[model samples]
Target: METRRDLRGILFVLVVFVGLAVIWRDLRYDFNFASDMHKAELGRRRETITQTVTSIALQTQIETQTELTTEIVKLSEDVSPAEKA
Candidate 1:
């Protein structure tokens, strides 16, 4: 009877250890998944910010070029009349 009781105790301890191991593995997997998702989100945000800055810079350059062209045309017209006189 004592030997049977010892066997049952050993079996119970083994089962408990297996359960704990499975729980630990599942928790580790969940943590890794969350970390990867966070990294991906950060990458997307950086790309969007870079694109917006580039677009703004291009727009400003175009506007400045247009203003300069208009001024040059006006100056040319003024000179043409004076030359004809």
Candidate 2:
């Protein structure tokens, strides 16, 4: 009877240890998944910000070029009339 009791105790301890190990593994997996998802979201946001900045820079350059072209045309027209006279 004593030996039976000792065997039961050992079995119980082993079961508890197994349960704790499973719980720990599950928690670790969840933590890793969350960390990976956060990193992916951050990368996506960084790309979007970079694209928006580039688009704004291009728009400003085009506007400046347009303004310069208009000024050059006006100056050319003024010179043409003076030369015709």
Candidate 3:
């Protein structure tokens, strides 16, 4: 029932379908790889943000402690003469 031309047409269609399938698979692989990379990058950014927040908190605490110490020394000086009398 098949002639040479019909057989050639079927072969061509099969080759095209296979090619398209391979292309689709490659695209899916690329999408998965890109998603994995983004997830890793996001995790690293979170870590960096946490470290930055901790550093800022420590600096603020150190500044507050220095301010308190200065106030205590000034108060002691003011009271020293009164106590002597």
Q: What is the TM-score of each candidate against the true structure?
A: 0.53, 0.54, 0.53
Instruction: Kindly give the stretch of ten consecutive residues in candidate 3 with the minimal lDDT sum.
Output: 1-10
State in Å the error of residue 41, model 2: 0.5
Q: For candidate 1, give the lDDT.
A: 0.59
Clash count of each predicted structure: 0, 0, 0
Q: After superposition, how far is residue 55 of candidate 3 from its true place, in Å?
A: 0.7
Candidate 3 lDDT score at position 4: 44
Write model 1 residue lDDT over 6-77, tens digit each, in one string.
555565565555555554554565456647776566456545555555555555556656766887888888
Please report, as a residue range, the 10-residue window in candidate 2 with the lowest summed lDDT.
Answer: 1-10
Local lDDT at 12 for model 1: 51
lDDT of each: 0.59, 0.60, 0.60
* lDDT by residue for model 2 (1-85), tens: 4465456556556655655555555456655764777656655654665565556556655665676688788888888666968
Worst 10 residues of 1 by lDDT: 1-10
Winner by TM-score between candidate 3 and candidate 2: 2
Off by over 4 Å in 1: 1-34, 81-85
